[model samples]
Target: MIRILFTMIAIGALTSAQAQTIESGSHSTTGYIKSDGTIENSSHSTVGYIKNDGTIENRSHSTIGYIKSNGTIENSSHSTVGYVKSDGTVENSSHSTIGYIKNDGTVENSSHSTIGYARGVKKEWAAVVYFFFKF
Candidate 1:
């Protein structure tokens, strides 16, 4: 009986480990995953969506949002789109020049905005929003 019990325990552990290995490769989650592979916060204050390779795609909050990548954004909260930078900055139509910082550490809002950073009269570096796609 003792041997049978040990076997069962070992089998359970092995199964769980095997499951984790499957997750380590190309993991994708529509919900949330704890550091221990346990699901948490299905839907609530922290309602978020993450992808495999530990990248967050879409995140929602009562007051703020955090997109952790420097890519094409089809839309934004204020009816705009943006991109990201390595310095966690976001460039959007709203902010125009000084793009905001994304939740992740990447520069953003460089897609449909200006491509210049200039100094203001106050001796502060400011973003100059101006760019023409030339149709």
Candidate 2:
């Protein structure tokens, strides 16, 4: 009986850990743009932040890049990496069409690959929200 209980507990723990990993990897949620320019997930977790100067920072508060007023996303070295167009489309710095934010908040990569999605608002609203909060 003791061995059985131990085995079950171990299994449960393993399963829980795996679930957390999966959740953290491709988690989708409605993020909010705080008054201070910090972005928080649906669960109120601080994923990153955007500074007034357009610097993007991760949860650890490390500067990653910047988002230009024109919607261009640049690296820390100020090189343009990607951009979000006014039409809700995302593209690489090379100007090649990458992907688009659909009417349902789905985000796809250049290959039409689903990186993740947004929740809570209409397509346009979601796009606008993401445009400011994107990291």
Candidate 1: minimum summed lDDT over ten consecutive residues — where? 121-130
Q: Taking the tens digit of each residue's C-alpha lDDT, what string does model 1 give over 32-129?
A: 33332222232422333323322233333132222333343332242334443344354554544445332321212345332222211000001111
Give the number of the best model, judged by TM-score.
2
TM-score of 1: 0.26
The C-alpha lDDT values of all candidates are 0.30, 0.60
**Model 2 lDDT per residue over 53-124, tens place:** 777788899887777788788777888877778777877778777677765557666677776565432333
Model 2 global lDDT (CA atoms, 0 to 1): 0.60
- Runs off by more than 4 Å, candidate 1: 1-46, 53-70, 76-80, 93-95, 98-135
TM-score of 2: 0.54
- For candidate 1, give the lDDT of residue 25: 13
